[model samples]
Target chain A: MNARARLLVFALGALLLGGAYMAALSQLAPLGRGASAYADILNRVCVRERHITDVVTAVNFDYRGFDTLGEEFIMFTAVMGAVLLLRRGKDEVQAPQEDELTSRRGRRRSDAVALAGVVFTAVLLLFGSYVITHGQLTPGGGFQGGVIASTALWLVYLSGSYKVMRQVGPKPLVEAAEALGAAGYALVGLIGLFQGAAFLQNTLPPGSIGSPFSGGTVPLIDIAVGLEVSGGFVLLLLTFMEEVLEIRLH
Target chain B: MLNIFCYSIAAWVLLIGLYGVVTSRNLIHLVLCLSVMETSTYVLLTLIGYRVGGTAPVFADIPVGTKAVDPVVQALMLTDVVVEATVMALLLALAVQAHKRTGSLDPHDLRALQG
Candidate 1:
């Protein structure tokens, strides 16, 4: 359909949807007055039973861990599919790939931006790792931290350190990390099952509250998720860069 | 009655995003419109779970038994964001591949599937 026709249809649909949404809003508890018994229970029991300071982390990695597991694999499969879609076809010439390498040599490198990127990469990595490891303690968790860490991987390229970036996170290494992350999560749950407890149970020692060792399997699961997300995104960035570079050269 | 503001904002965002998607000629823009719609969902979820005087669900600093907004929806939002990112990346990749095959980024021009 033409653009105008499509807009007309959309306007009609929007009106209907808006009306339905307004009708539904009344059902929602007023702002900041919503009751969540489940949240209340988790908030109360998490620290005492799971030794987790962050109830969100407890729910994600413990109570509803299976959901996170599914989410992680969704990410893994999406990355894999993206890479495949972006892959150089069999008949595609390898000439443009090498052309980009030589072209980079003649390109102007900015010392100021390079310095800034270097500083940013270091700080982002430190903060990201802190977020990753401190999931049980803080509101941040593996997914949040992993994405932050992945931006650090991007900064390595941004700072005119493309060669170093490639050296640090090659496809094979990133693939392995991503795979291990996906597998490790499943294994954590399996360990619970093998122990005759419920799958994804808080199987590990609920380490002493407020300590790094606390939250039993939570920290372990968080680290694995961190690896998975970071690796997956790095792989994604690398694949897109390669494609874009070839497009630019050709 | 004033509480409707947050939900109204969410609804407005959703409608705007849908309008963008309907009018979008470029695949990348359409994908972004979808992300905008997802953003509306996140807003709605947070608004639904908001509690008066609630702190964050973490008890690391606050004393125990402190009231906090719902953690469940926040957890859902986290996954929602990650999935959206990866899915957006995948969609963009597909767009790239489509362009490579058809030499066109305009959705209208690419409507006919070619083997």
Candidate 2:
């Protein structure tokens, strides 16, 4: 189509969309004042049942835990798909000699960059652990913390050669940890099942609300999810990096 | 008035993303446009969840009678964000493979499947 016609069509489409959106917005109940169907119920029950301060965590891991399980599997499947798509094939030429490739491509390490990477990695790892463990008490949780933790591995890749990264995090070990993390989450849910409760039921005792030890299986699920996310992200990065390095063939 | 503003802005963002996707020549640009659409949804949900004078829903240091913003939408948005990230990563990976196989990033050029 001509540019004029295309622009006219686009304008018409936008106008229609705007009208539809306005209509929908007009029908929506007033914000903040509109009563949620189950907010009050959840608010009352969540604190009492989970004894957790962060109601969001309670909702995610307990109230709607089955949904969270599906979310975890979504991540799992996406990473698995990435691995399958990016894996080195039989026709791809493997690096015959690691030392030769390193000597050829590896630049002299910058002390400043290496030092900064190490400091940042350490800080991120600690913060990630804190976020994952204290998920029930704080605003952040496993997903956020896991993404942060994976950045440490990314920094390792940035500051050092592939060889150093391999030494620090072997591919097989990371993959296994990813699988284990996903499985561990499922296993936690199964415990609820074996206890004659619903899947992902909060079987363990929820301790005092504010303490780190509270939230029972919530914290454990958070840890498992954190591990899975960190490993998945790191693996995704490694595969792309391998492609960049020509370690994997086109 | 504030609700109108927030909702309109969200709609505008979504429309802009849609326009970009419709006109995007490159796959990477299309992916970015998709992200913009996702972000618009996030903004809409957040705005919907906001209370006029409510504080965060956390029980830390707040008065007993103080109103707090809705926590359910926040929880849902959290999961949505993770899903968006995963989907983006997968799309980029597929884009990489497409480029490797076809030697082009343009949707027009990637017409092998077209009948």
Candidate 3:
């Protein structure tokens, strides 16, 4: 259709949407005691008496921990597959040197940025550890913390070169960490089985509600997840930047 | 009405993604669009399952007052987000390889891989 027709159609659609939203709002019960009554009921019957964070922890680590395991593996395999697919052949020429190493257009980083990146990497490392350790009690968790950790290398890469990234981002070390993380996750489930509980079931003592180590298997799993996620994301990004972005080391 | 809102948003996302996949010459754009579509559906699904004015599932502090929102959907979304992220990363990697092999980012140029 012509542009005018398209504009008319868009306007009509917006009008219809506005009308529908108004109708829905009219149907919705007014916000008052009735609307919040559910919250009051929960407070009196359940939440006011029990600790909400503990239950969230249990659900995340125990009840549905198996799913988290699978999620971690998904990340792990993606990184592995990316690396495998993107590896350069032995005879392939090393990417020729570029002048602007710090360009955001791709992975190219300037020398000055590379120097500053080392400092940023240290910050990310500390922040990531803090997130993973406090995951059980805070809004941040292993997965989020792991990504933050992995992103530390981007600065390192930007500041200097892939050499810097490789030195600190050692693939062998990352691989070992990934493997251990996976094993730790599995071991947690095995412990549950050995205790005669369901697989991935929380058998460890929950400790006190607000304590750092209070969430039993949740904190342990969080640590494992943190490692796996960080390793996986870094690996994936490295593979892509190396292969697709074609950032040369020399 | 809420269902309609959720479904419409889901449809809009899917259609926009479909358009991007079909019309975009760049492989990376296609993957990005696909992620956008996936995110839209996730939001729709979460909204469909949400209890209006419902709180998160967990009775950590209360004896037993509020009915918990569906933990199943929240848990599933967590898994879904991770899976989608993995898939997108892999797709981007493949797109890179395709670019390297063909010296082009257009999907129309990638015929060697096809039977």
**What proportion of the real contacts between chains A and B does each prediction keep?**
0.86, 0.48, 0.33
How many backbone clashes does every candidate have?
Answer: 2, 0, 33
**Model 1: chain A TM-score against the true structure:** 0.92
What lDDT would each prediction earn against the true structure? 0.86, 0.81, 0.66
Worst 10 residues of 3 chain B by lDDT: B58-67
CAPRI-style quality class for the chain A–B interface of candidate 1: high
- Across B31-103, the per-residue lDDT of candidate 1 in tens digits comes to 9999998899999998987889998899999987999889999999997798789999999999998888888
DockQ values, each candidate: 0.85, 0.59, 0.26
TM-score of 1: 0.95
lDDT of 2 by residue, B32-52 (tens): 999998898888888787777
**TM-score for chain A in each prediction:** 0.92, 0.88, 0.69
Error of 1 at A81 (Å): 1.2
**In model 2, what lDDT does residue A11 have?**
86
State in Å the error of residue A234, model 3.
1.2
Highest-DockQ candidate: 1
lDDT over C-alpha atoms for residue A217 of model 3? 79
Q: Please report how far candidate 3 places residue A172 from its true position, in Å.
A: 1.0
